[model samples]
Target: MASSSSSSSLKFTVRRCQPQLVPPAIPTPREVKPLSDIDDQEALRTHLPVIQIYRKQASMAEKDPVQVIRQALSQTLVFYYPFAGRLREGPHRKLMVDCTGEGVMFIEADADVTLDQFGDSLQPPFPCFHELLYDVPGTQEITNAPLLLVQVTRLKCGGFILAIRLNHTMCDGPGFKQFMSAWAEMARGATKPSIAPVWRRELLMARDPPRITCNHREFEQVQDTLPSSDQNLVQRSFFFGPLDIAALRRLIPQHLQHCTTFDLITACLWRCRTKALQIEADEDVRMMCIVNGRGRFNPPLPVGYYGNAFAYPAAVTTAGKLCRNPFGYAVELINKVKGEMTEEYLQSVADLMVMKGRCLFTTARSYMVSHLARLNLKEVDFGWGDAVYGGGAKAGAGRFLGVSYFCSAKNGKGEEGIIFPICLPAEAMERFAQEFNLMLGNKSQPQTSSATFIMSTL
Candidate 1:
């Protein structure tokens, strides 16, 4: 696999206009809004980078995507005004949104290349991502920084790429999807978003007296031994089409054939990854599955509540047991942990977060997977039809080790399937590919490659 910058041979320069602050079109109240316990977690303090590429469409050829989205963003901010505010920290590192309507950073640029030049597949890690979404200095801190940073780069072919640096402290993947869809609706000239934005952070607050009703092993402190240097790791995207999935399903027991796509893929990847890492036989390895808490509420959370509303329930086992057992073993462990996510479980997590002073999620020998396949990210359009690609700009969440995202995507050949970006050491990555190929019965070629690449190490 090639690095992000080296993946593409086409060289092009981007001429950028001065970045400006775009505030809400309408004035909002000057009040401070407290974030939910889940929103203020220590692990989510960094900004999440995302990208969307739009091709020139006949229907929208007459319009400028940058201008359209810029105007729409202002209008959308009226309903989702908190995005225009800056984050502030109180005593105990508690976070709050200072709703000053200060505005978000926006930039417009024109690239010399066209959409086709980016290669057949637009899935991440996208090449020249840093150029697409330049991180303006003094605007990336967790607090006292722009909540949203957007850069719209126009291509020579009239299509454009929309890149963003979103404050993870404000919302999770699903919540950000909602916000983007709403912004798209605005661009299409909707008077109001079909789903109104809601800000009831109090709903996910820790219970009174903060009781830890259930075990929260995902947050337990551990002596993390993962190497800090990214030079030892490489990022790559793997495609799982219908045939690939069917092949995996054959490994499971007949009774578990009805398992979900996420269940099957998570299990297969966990087994393959663990084997690739070659941890000690007795060492405990864990897989943390991010479960959305929206539906777990007795009465579901409001339709448009865009705060962090997810919990990571982990499945744990010894490396030897996980590797030696059949594939069904991993799936069962995943299914069991997923089943533990309930209303009570969410409350327990909130309590645990507060009790632990918002400690970071355990990273020791742990692989975290977040399923974005159901987030409806493909539906986000700024009047030029659905994007050619839209979602996380790269693999592995910002500085967090051993993180991966599963999303629905189309290949260069236009085949729709599940695509996941994995980052691992060069040696481990080669081993991972070999293990995966062995499962699929394709030993001829072990390594898988995609057009997108990660320029920066790790």
Candidate 2:
């Protein structure tokens, strides 16, 4: 018998129902090409692990959903062809997508548990969540890995969890959302996507001369090499309802120009995560933000450019200063870093990465944030009314991969709230929960300024 804490107690079992490999409708002109280091970097951004749940309801089509989704994906891949390709070895020991028209792996799984068993508080980095996602077991590298692998697990209650594992370099969060939405649309009988994908890799290609034209602080290489780290971290979900969000925003002064929801939550997270970790007073801290570069450009990326159009913009600070200071100061620091993510700066960042010939991001003393608050979860319908849950699967893996995500979900009143997920040390998590509850429960005090003391029960 499994232990009480074991996910086995949940009665989850994943077995291959059938081999479902769906390829594009058309044959691709055979071509083998080397992905530019920038493109290569994006391609290997992640195992691109994602897990979403959609409860079976009367609103869904009466037809077979597996077949419907499979057909839709097959048709969608005709336009988004790169997904059907597999990664292969390149000359420099780097990776490249071998554009051989191989289909994506689609598996059907069954679990004895019911969706109701999960209740409404479903979240990620769950104990058995890792088992739900499909990947090459025991390996994290994407080389020679299938570009896409999806597993659909049917629950006892008839609802299902759709787990998608893709190569991160294939698309950014926004781009992936675009592809999935179109796939959903095709499932609804659309001939083609409303906004056809634009696959012009050259838009992000390195320049002919590969020159560093402008200042690029984001790409500057670190002079010191940090030692290895592996903190036994656990992921948890933190939800902030409308009122809680408003209260947080109120904490920041309104007169501050860039004082938006993004800055408000970022301030809360940065401060709380820092204090939770109990970093030294002088220890460096930074919030690495993934900013979409599409709009920052003059002729913004075409509507359907389902490729990486985002840049990592980080805000650096010290742990003691971030936690000790008022929330307004953190917001200001965030806004300043945000203001620099202009078109000119984005171009320079590209040039700098091109000069370095590698795609890397800030690692040490950094807490990254990916705000998916704007993702329209309702549109991800595969003939169902809407997905019961649609958001990020795992924030990330390991301590060095410090990441926090702010996502959205529809509530009973058709309203949206942010779902922030993070993984921290067990002891830190205890402190974090106490500190967060204190901040949210302090409704009696007016959020005057950061200087005002906020008491905590912990």
TM-score of each: 0.95, 0.87
- What TM-score would you give candidate 1 relative to the actual structure? 0.95
Error in Å for residue 353 of model 2: 2.4
Q: How accurate locally, in lDDT, is each candidate?
A: 0.84, 0.67
Pairs of residues clashing in candidate 1: 4-453, 4-454
How would you encode candidate 2's per-residue C-alpha lDDT over 117-201 as one tens digit per residue?
Answer: 7644455544555456554443355666567888777766767778888777777778889999889899899999998888766
Off by over 4 Å in 1: 1-8, 225-229, 443-458
In Å, residue 432's CA in model 2 sits off its true spot by 1.9
Q: After superposing candidate 2 on the true structure, give the runs of residues whose Cα lies further than 4 Å from its correct spot.
A: 1-9, 18-20, 33-37, 42-44, 59-61, 89-95, 136-140, 213-231, 397-400, 410-415, 442-458
